[model samples]
Target: MIDRVPAQFRGVADGVVAVAAADPRFLAVIVNGSVANGQPDEWSDLDLVVVCADPYRSEVVAQGKDFAAAAGPLLVAFTGEHVGEPRLLIALYGPPVIHVDLKFMGLGDLGERVEDGLVLWQRHDSVQQQLDATSAAWPQPDAQWIEDRFWVWIHYVAAKIGRGELFEAVDGLGMIRSAALVPSIVARRTDRPTGVRRIEQLAPEMVPALARTVAMPDRADCLRALRAAVELYVEVRGDDVVQQTEAEKAVLGYLDGFPA
Candidate 1:
């Protein structure tokens, strides 16, 4: 069984909520993600949102990290205001790495936005209205970007292997991220959210096929997984976008060179 969070950590969350509620500019504070989903393991971290009267009007971004940091010495890793979005802050803490993704949303407009799962811990009328307006929008992955990145990343992996950099090759073998594009495309084909991870549960058959295709016994196996990853990419994207790409040609040539 996963260890329940220490009372001190719970108090930290409560304290954060209290701080937000006391501020006139802050209308509501929502606890979301893993904790909200109730699937928290011992290493789980808090994901929260601080809904403000005006998203861009206040300095919520600057203060959020400071606030979380002040809560504990474990809050050492900070990803400052992701992707130029002032309304969000991402941080990590604890030895095992717990992530906290904090977002600031406009009070009146909060309900208009949609997130998959949100649990409101503290809310005013204005905040509740905003939360009510929230809609659920599935995130879309950039297929073209994934396609291009797959080839580039694999070639780098191949080069590392060629240079006898086994550790680097293993470290770089993040086929999961590459394999994710396939499921995203499949999900879109089935009319669901794209870019959703842990999709093996959705389609168990694909998981084994993916594993088989990407399995490698040694350096050769690494290359095999890479080739399979490329072929899988082609299968997902179709020939039109990826057919003429070098990755496609390389996989084909590799198959040709395979000994009988």
Candidate 2:
């Protein structure tokens, strides 16, 4: 299955390059996003960044639509340029919708401001220095911010669940985002990643037992998850800071209004 998809991607990529190469302004071509991140699932899309000498050149901008259409009868959703960077979102005529985000960057203008990107093709040594400098500046998740938001967001999740707002409740949970911080803290405490998935998988036994503190039943599982989420937040935070605050109190009051 993977072998077949790459073949299709190659065909589309080759067509894009062939059209792009016709113009001398185009300096290089890069493919980034999930595909470059080494985490492509079956649903992943081909995110291509077209690096050119002048990204805003009349010829390049004009050809953007045509370049996308070269992918055959696929439905192309063009998101235009962001801060002068052109983009396209495409879905091919296949079961798995293939998304392609195209960005045009100028050679001389490519600088330290950009994120770490792969150099699929390069015309000169200038892009090398910029790519290396940008790579060094990759954003690391802020530990203090994550720690502060954990407790505060849990109360919001509880209130959302209590109110029967499932989508908002799930978003408020932030399990995946908060989970990233836990592994780092746990690694510091246990000296290993532990390769756990959900917070419950690696939650310490010594933390306050939440079974009695949080109510649960067959119908209110989302509320259970929300309460468990709060307990996990308290566990990860430790005594580094107190969970109780004016904002948390207000959120708890809001949740209290929605009786179990």
Candidate 3:
């Protein structure tokens, strides 16, 4: 599997293995994301899960920069706190730049993961054993959960449009696409409802509607995109979901008051 790693990333992956192999604290260095997902290309980023002994995980994460620097010519590195993952060290490496995410986790933490990773380097077979013992499951979007919030969000965006806050209105539409429609659309093509990821490849039929959601910060354009978003959401939201009829009616009526 290591051989399948793209040429541009091979060096960094090899460097990580070489460094991790010698480190007693690190139990395993597993590669995930596009590489492990079996769809890696030249543009793919190297995502790694560096398993450290439970006692040392904090220290290892604290000094993640040092470990990343040892593995490659790290140009810039930052903890993934902004993304709500403090354990992740997002790094950029090279004269030929490549992005890598090094997530330092305790050995026990491997029990819960979104997907299986390729065991690049391990101190023993324990890593594989743990992986075999547990299943990797990505969380699916709950239709009902989206349904409850959908009308509320639509009303919020409508208000923004009415107030002539085109910038906020445009951004709100993008959020709707990502949070509601994109996942709903992607779900139709693949079991994995990855928001907007590879939408063209995964759900080509929805491309025209998806494109219509993109507005140029103009009031009329935002209103049009908002209408498109509503229609698309209704189309993709499966028959099983409960309809928020009254709320939908109120929101649509409110939005109708807006001048195109």
**Each model's lDDT:** 0.59, 0.55, 0.87
Clashes by residue pair, model 2: none
At residue 28, what lDDT does model 1 achieve? 67
Ranking of all candidate structures by their TM-score, best first:
3, 1, 2
Q: In candidate 2, how many Å is residue 127 off?
A: 2.7
Cα lDDT of model 2 by residue, 1-260, tens digit: 12323554766666666666666677777766555656566666777777666545556656666666764445655655443444333335332345566665565445633355566666676667666655333334444555556556666666566666776666544453345335434544442243343335455552244332333333276666665655554555544444457766665576557567
Per-residue error for 209 in candidate 2, Å, reads: 14
- Best candidate according to TM-score: 3
**Runs of candidate 2 exceeding 4 Å displacement:** 1-5, 33-44, 54-63, 71-73, 80-97, 108-117, 132-136, 174-219, 237-258
Whose lDDT is greatest here? 3
lDDT by residue (63-179, candidate 1, tens digit) is 766766654445554544455666576766654455666676766545455454444554557655545567655455556556666666666766776776766666566554444
Stretches of candidate 3 off by over 4 Å are none
Cα-based TM-score, every candidate = 0.66, 0.62, 0.95
User: Considering lDDT, which of the candidate structures 1 and 3 is the better prediction for this target?
Assistant: 3
Please give the lDDT score at residue 172 for candidate 1: 63
Rank candidates, lDDT, best first.
3, 1, 2
Candidate 2 lDDT: 0.55
